[model samples]
Target: MSNNKIIDLGSSEDPLVLDCGKSIGPIKTAFTTYGELNETKSNAILVCHALTGDQYVASEHPITKKDGWWSLLIGPEKSIDTNKYFVICPNVIGGCMGSTGPNEINPKTGKEYGLDFPVVTIGDMVKAQKLLIDSFGIEKLFSVIGGSMGGMLVLEWLSKFPSYVFSAIPIATTTNHSAQNIALNELARQAIMADPEWKSGNYNIENTKPVKGLSVARMAAHISYLSEQSLHEKFGRNLQNKNKIEFSFDADFQVESYLRHQGFKFVDRFDANSYLYITRAMDYFDLKAENNGSLIEAFKNTNSHILCASFTSDWLYPTSENKVIIKAFNALGLNVSFVEIETDNGHDSFLLDEPEFFQTIKGFLDATYKKL
Candidate 1:
């Protein structure tokens, strides 16, 4: 296998145990792999994806036919340098992509899981990836890299299986979702469930979908991902291809039109129920909580080296949040590095073509890989 297709683990006696204490079996993990695993399997790296990403990391998205979201950063000669390392990216279990998610059918009822699907956490996501990695016969990973929710998964992977990971890069993510972040996620969930067509998350059975509700949810969440400076610079008060204001709520401003477009396009590819599940998982993420409210305790004896980063304009996961993680690593006397990139690209800066961000990753990984 070229690691470019789906791999169905099928049903086994051993099921994935969730943080909620529920066990699910026969999970189908959809992943894409690039480069090749060497004889010793020491050149493998795991790239986790953000909220809307899928397994198609450096390849064309099958649904959109557009270039991969992170194509600018991960390729043969790019910062990640696929030519020198084997990279694996898998869709989270509760994701809308090919992995087993809310859209999958329940074996007993033979219907889509929908709201019935189990709530998954960052730990659950990493546990599933462990299964996939073990299937590849790769015991230890050279590095695990991601930003935002992907970054959360990176931290979880290192925390849960320190011996299995050598290095980690968590960019623009917090150790836990703040109260404001939780509130914002709740707003999106309310928007989706409030739509009459949602039908209590049984829209699939009713042969209808909540398009308007999901679109509004996406629009609301999209605003939080950007900064005031970014929005103003990109759109300002510019009219949307019009000579005068429409006088009505018909997207009079260019920014409004852009957000509407983002919302509409999102509903086409993402599942509302999956969005609810994933956001809930993120809200429940609190590493310190698991370690008696002490961030330092969470890292107890971890040996994996960490490279933490934050963006100047990212209000979602600010530098303050990254500092907490860095402090914990330092308290543990662990090998860790940090950088606050100066940029106006907001939380999405990690995804954009930031030369310094690219170089930092290239330099860190290149130097780390040599020691392995």
Candidate 2:
């Protein structure tokens, strides 16, 4: 296969075992792969995504009809540089894409699972993806990289299956969800579930869904991805649709208009119940549980080279949180490097078109590829 070609893995229809000894029934994971698998299938890179992201990493988005979300980093001669390595991006198990999510019909009832779907965690998602990797017959990965929730996935991969990857890059993520982060998530869920139109999360029928509630939730969640400076620079006190104020609940300021637009667009594509379930999964993730409940112990036997990045203005996860991860790597004296990017991009910085981030990614991949 040429580097430009992409292979598709449709689904996992069988009952899948969970690390917790529970079972996931009829699970289907949707994923896309770019580039060739190489003679030894050693050039594979797993592209884990943040919340609300999907497997369309470097392809066109079917829903938005726009380019893939991370096309900025995963293209010819780019950071991920599909020309050189096989890249795989999977729609997370809890996502609203082609993956089996809450919106998917429950074969048992012939209706959307909605709240009936089993709640999944970051570890569960990783285990599911591991099945996909094993199907390829590739025992080890060239690298695993992600941001925000994606970053958390990277951390979990290192801890859960340390010997399965060659290197890891986790950007702008936390060791565990903080009280403040959990509070924000709770508020967003409340907003979505609060709408009278929610109708108990079974919005798949009736040709209707909870727009106001979902939009409000997206609007609130979007704010956390940005910083005050970013908000000021992108949309400040500038008036919306008028030079003067017509204050009524109308989107008078540009910021309000942006947030409103963000909310409205999100509701069209995402499921309200999936939002609740995914966020809850993230909240329940605690990385230190396996290694006698100690974070440092998790890395003692790890050999995967790691690159950890944090942003200066990302108060959501914050630089301090990144330090906790670095400290763990230090205690084990693991092969890890830390870079706190000096930027005003906040948590979403890892998502945006940042040239410096691209460079760091390129450098990390190149150093690892040379070893291979």
Candidate 3:
């Protein structure tokens, strides 16, 4: 294995053939691994990341220097228990991390892929991950775990390569993008495209960034990740710095200030074009359509044990969405478990400090490991 964490696939005859019928070659997958793979490689777990997430799953984020996004739930003695399982999280192809995304140079044009990069689907993302797993010489993953967009990838994995996955945990995600979800994504995309600095996705050439547009997009999307109850508890009508509300458009409320901070900070670490591509991929995701308009048919090939979880307050991907999946599993008589955790943290409850959520995951993985 190379000392550098970034795994270089190098120019090869077997380039990544995408779902769009286009091929991208010499792909590089940047990832991080925790713990060690057992001799049989039966203890390896693949951890898929959500939107705006990188492969730095359990390490300090190189850019922000903050703890890893899932540091709370993954470590030596954490819920997932890194000490027992080898965990690998790779930055998806459309991501801005070290992955080969729109920000990277195209071998043919010698410039960034920009808008020329083919739109990728969740299936494409899982295909890229499958290559990474093959490179590791792992025949079958002990378990695949993820939430939100990550959860979508988990579903894609189970559908595309049923035999390669032993178990799966898809948290707070649906098999297909809902109409409301597509509308929200369109709003965010319009925000980015509206900025003149975007320059038709060639923002890098002019040395100008679509910061304002991207910031607004992030702010808008951030609201959907939190529940009304949690937002109220955190910053309900509270003044930012003054006792009285300012008449100007300046941020007067604490909530406004908080959102502005999140928006601006996000721009510093994320790419506008990459954001567009990833969200477009999500909007195009419809497993039912891919499987002859039958959502249950998509999982017909998978015998992998599955644990589907959702939060009561997660309106974006509510318990109802998970129930839909559980019903499908029941129809197939597959070994599946469903849990609706009571939380006020909304769709992001999986990422928050919910003891019950952690316990549920720990318990499931532990039981699954014993069987393995």
Candidate 4:
């Protein structure tokens, strides 16, 4: 069973202001918590979810009936051990999960927000999360951890509310979206918008869905999440059941069938419009630009111990991109640790079962908690 919980934050009187100069009230935040909060509430750790991830960090997913996205790394005696730390994971505002998003009803129009939802930014998401953190009366978090887009949220927390975070781990992520990253996201967006069923984002009102468009979008984006070596190792040019190559334009190769499965299954649980919005938010993240083009200046305020990690084959957010963040921290003379895990799993390495990755995080958290 899913262990999701819902909380209402930012009422009409104190609406959440967005980077797009818009305001939303009574934002619904879906979250889940594991372990127990100590009397002082000092052992709380905020685990941010990545794109396409929900609040079911270490629990079963209600829709997919599969283990939580980070199930391997979190639990009773896992890396972010629930036996000792209180972990809170919130579905971001522009997500398709139980959180507020384009698919959610708009109280003003009595219909789904759809295209009317304000263009949310990474900063806006972090602001909404802060409200949830406040609702718990958590003055400070023991640690904040995440990977990829989730890592972006971790960095945002460190930048926007440095004092509130004690330690942070941002894995396989960058401070900003590189040009290549933006281009890749744009490709996915165009794929969705090109479908005839999209109907200008009004498909929901017509009782239709851009499933094909969304599927293709997922297919294209999924390739970026893996490395060439992993794909080759997993399913070379092997045929999909048949021995001879099929001359038709069908899924002849195992890899082709695998991607198609990933794409179609993704559309089953994810909303097309939510995909558009969340990807746009990721493309717009630029921590350096937010702080006047000074990465060091962005983090000069607080003294939180930080750990930045990147996978060796993560071309999407390569080790080089991650090093930029480390350089900034080093420039400020902050207590920071950086590790590049040797792996061929690419950007998705953080989500996989890597012994070194798990040990690195476990060792760091154990040391950090002992200090407190």
lDDT of candidate 3 at residue 278, scale 0 to 100: 94
Error of 2 at 344 (Å): 1.1
The candidate that achieves the highest lDDT relative to the unseen native structure? 4
Q: Judge candidate 1 at residue 259 and give its lDDT.
A: 95
User: Which regions of candidate 1 deviate over 4 angstroms?
Assistant: 1-3, 10-12
Kindly report which residue pairs in candidate 4 clash with one another. Answer: none
lDDT of 4 by residue, 1-372 (tens): 667899989887889999999999989999999999999999999999888888998999888888899999999999989999999999999998888999999877889999999999888999999999999899999999999999999999999999999999999998999999999999999999999999888898988889999999999889999999999999999999899897998999999999999999998899999889999999999999988999988888858889999999999999999999999999989889999999999899998899999999999999998877
Give residue 82's error in model 1 in angstroms: 1.0
**Candidate 2 lDDT by residue in tens digits, 260-346:** 999999877788888998898788887876567788887666789899999999999998999999999988888889888988878
- Each model's lDDT comes to 0.90, 0.84, 0.89, 0.92
Candidate 4 runs further than 4 Å off: none
Compose the digit string of candidate 3's lDDT tens values, residues 254-327. 99999999999999889999899899888888888988988789989989999999999998888887788788
RMSD list, candidates in order: 1.4, 2.7, 1.6, 0.8
Clashing pairs in 1: 3-33
lDDT score for residue 218 of model 1? 95
Is 2 or 3 the stronger prediction by lDDT?
Answer: 3
Query: Model 2 has how many clashing residue pairs?
Result: 0
Candidate 3, 115: how far from true, in Å?
A: 0.5
If ranked by lDDT, best first, what sequence of candidates would result?
Answer: 4, 1, 3, 2
